[model samples]
Target: MKLRLTAAALLFPLLCGAAAPQGAPGEKMRTEKVLRMFLSTSETGLDPAVASDNATLSLLENLFDPLLRYDYLARPAKLRPNTAAAMPEVSADGLSYTFRIRPGILFTPDPAFKGARREVTAQDYVYSIKRLYDPTLKSPWAYMFEGKIAGDETLRKRYGPDVPVAGLQALERYTLRIRLNAPDNNFLFYLATAATGVVAREVIEAYPGQAGNHPVGTGPFMLGDWKRSDRIVLLANPDSTAVFHATPGHNAEDRALAAALEGKRLPRVDRVEVKIAEEFQGRMLGFLNAEYDYLEQIPESMTDMVVRDGRLKPELAARGIVLSRFPVLQTYYMWMNMNDPVVGGYGKDKVALRRAISMAYNNAEDIALLKKGFAIKAESPLPPNVLGYDPSYRSPVPYDPALANALLDRHGYSRRDPDGFRRAPDGKALTLTMHSEATVGGRLRDELWRKCLNAIGLRVVFKSDKKTEIIKASRLGTVQMFESNWIADFPDGDNFYQLLYGPNAGRANYARFDLPAYNLRYEQARRLSDGPERQKLYFEMNQLIHAYNPWVPLTHVLSGDLRHPWLKNYKRHPVEFTAWRYLDVDVAERARSARGRGGNR
Candidate 1:
């Protein structure tokens, strides 16, 4: 069912007991706790293995613990030990990695634990990694370990759960050894991701389809209540004894954040209540009314109202709202399916068609008009702030409608129908189907694509589907073209390059681009450390991608998050999602802020 974020329809009644004023009797706020927030989209699920979307992963970051985690205040995204005793010991060959699990860590109470001790061990991580190879699960992130983990792909392809994976093994109760097929420098980064979060083996056996909804992990927060698409609550894990001591920051900004967060127990807020606010306007209004403590991403539609000259509006600033802006390691692009007949081919004509389409679309205009100058026009798949991203690089496909028309005309697409739309070489109407989610922003982006395609005399039609459905269709190679984005799973160029790798086709390679030369460079780059030599390979691969035009690199967004004054020690991470741990709420201050704002409640 489609979620509608209308305040009147979705918001709980202000008079209801659950919506009572802060510090009200029987509410968690009475104890000066509770962090209220909202989710703009419905989460797919909380299972780390299958949670692919940002919403689900965001929650899982707190619900589960990875061996290593990104330092909250680090700009370059430094990895630190979380569940591991320290960084894994790597062999000289870089193929074998050994990790010692931290002791005293226990999973939140669950039926799966039965009467046994809940202490996390190396065996738990071994069991979790094996789940990625489970064919029945069909995890989108399985590609992260597919051929890299020794014997994993073979077991999945040949044995099909009949045999165990030989690569990941628990050497002792506390030690785990992982053998990779090749030297992968980014392997540790993958382990730091939520997808590698260890789960209890018994939990999977106890709750089959409901494991995701009923999560049991060794993290700061535990799942409390979930009302499908309406609301989700995460309560502080009583079993958690984790405390965060601030690490030295690299800059003044980092130092300031560290000063505010130093020596604090994880999950300062006792509870996190996330309301479903699908509509941007409603979400922003809710924040203004003090119904929410923080606004995740500043809505593009409300950018002007909330921000002026890169600063929060004077009115909002007066109300004690703090705005944090940082360039995220993500790239939003429009993918052209290489498998489609009209748009796909290795021939000159087909390449010209794709290049023409890329040139016709103006990313600068999209940023100014649609994104309100909140995004950087991307010239390559690798966005700024990630390794191998070159600031000097320029996009070869500039906005040139005349050049686009000339290319199309020269490529035998010159014939125009009665309605003025260009026809294919075979005299068939050249109509392209672009798929997008049926959200407000999605519709706006679709309209922009329609405008640009029409300028080049090409007819464009939009196919609106749920975000999950569109993603599934793209992975299945059923969608001709679609809008999508990739946030870096790690700070490496290989993460972006692998999206076009031939073997990854029908998975992360939604464009179905299969160039042998590009794949070789990607493999070579993945094995090398981040340096000038590896950077050269990245540049070369990016050049090939630019010429191929499988995707029209759109924008790299500067995430703008607004937090109420009562929210303390809030710092945005460029790549990490576990920032909630360091955040603290001033309950009395929040009550005053809410009381001062005489809206609805």
Candidate 2:
């Protein structure tokens, strides 16, 4: 069912002028209040392998926890240990790794799961790893872990017809061993990804098609009720009690205090209710009116009001709303596919062309207008937060139309036609397709791209697609220059390196960039346990990619969520791991007390 109501109407349910008691009668009686949320855009499906979109992935991350999880500050926080207890474990030869696994952990299979809820074993991890590469399953995420492990080839050969990654073996029921053909210092951190959740053998064999929808996991929360196009309800796993409440060093005191108040039991909230509203304005208004006790990715329009009005800010303050700001490792950049045949071949001057275009962009103006003063201008693939990020690696290309024209002219793109578009000396027009998704910033960037290129006498055709279609077009090589964003999977530079390097899964190297030299450096960075050595390799690789300019890295996008007056402990990491485990958001009493707090006229 769809509800169409204005922001004012939506706020009424949440702002009914009294603090609803904790465990109040009626809908509020549930142990922890369900913090309803909005998506702002609808998801087509919940298939984790295929659902690469952020909105869907965000929901999935909340519902499922990997063997490793991130803490409040976005550091590696182990959930279920496998092989290694804590990271930075070096092997005897620096190639052979042996890590410890947390024993006695159980899997929360779907209640509908016909199989018994068995204890998650080392073999379960192996089977789950293999299941991703199962031929019949054919999950796209399978490629992410391919070729990184030992016996990958042997498993591929054995399960060649069905599963390809059956090689990650269970040395014993309690212990797991992953042998890498080469050493990857960053490999352990990479394994802790949302894409790398462990699967149970019985759960896999029991119900094939319904798994992603009704996935069984060892994470903090389990999938309870998922109504497509409506809402998804995730109930906290009572089993994660200890791990869920263990505070990171930073929040140790806060958790202690909250625990003291609640008899030392952890995980303040019982359930998280995610509502699907698919519009930014509606989500913001719902937060303002209190329909939502908490909200993520608060709209820019409301930010101004929160900043200007002390009353509104205090109302939010009284309710324990926290507006957190952090230096996130997210970059919004343009991917230039160098190998597309439709576009000119990856020319001898391709790097020069890409670099020139990168320089031509107006970073300051783009941030100001398009980002609504929320983002920082990015100039390299290495966002400022990444270890290799070079502030001086900033684009040498200033926003100079004259310089752009000169570069094109010097490259023999000087021939002018009746319409005044420049052509190569061979009369081939210097044209390219500039495509972006239909986002407010995307449209602004498209306009900026068109204006700048036209000044250089380059004929650029502007095109926009829905979010999903744009991603599809990029993979098919139909896009020449496309706008895309990436947040670090882990703190390692390898996440950025592998994505821009040729041959990684999803080949986020949208450019299909193939440079053996760069790949060699990236491989070296991955293998060594030496921090200095890895940092050096990353620096060299960053320099090479910057020079090549396969992607015109625009700017690091700075963004945050604006919570409602009553939403407390609402924090999110820029790394894309959203966990309310440590958050002490109390909607029932807080919202009720917030009545007469906002100076209601």
Per-residue lDDT tens digits of candidate 2, residues 453-474? 7767777887877666777677
lDDT of 1 at 540: 88
Per lDDT, the best of the predicted structures is 1
TM-scores of all predicted structures: 0.92, 0.81
Global lDDT scores for all candidate models: 0.82, 0.61
Model 2, global lDDT: 0.61
In model 2, state the lDDT of residue 53.
64
The sequence of per-residue lDDT tens digits that candidate 1 reaches over residues 1-601 is 3222122212222312235586667754235377888877778767898887777888898889989888786657788888888888988988898999888898877656665658999989987887877766777778888888887866777634335667778899999999999988888899989999889988888988767867788888877777877888777776665677556556886687677666666877777888888777889888988888888678887888798988889899999998878788989999999999978878888898899899899787899988888898998998998888889988877899999999999988999999999998888888899998787888888889999999999999999987767877887788999989998888988889889998888778999999999999988898898899998998888889889899999999988888899888777777775477777888778767767875433
Each candidate: RMSD: 5.2, 6.4
Predicted structure 2, TM vs. truth = 0.81
> On a 0 to 100 scale, what is the lDDT of residue 381 in model 2?
66
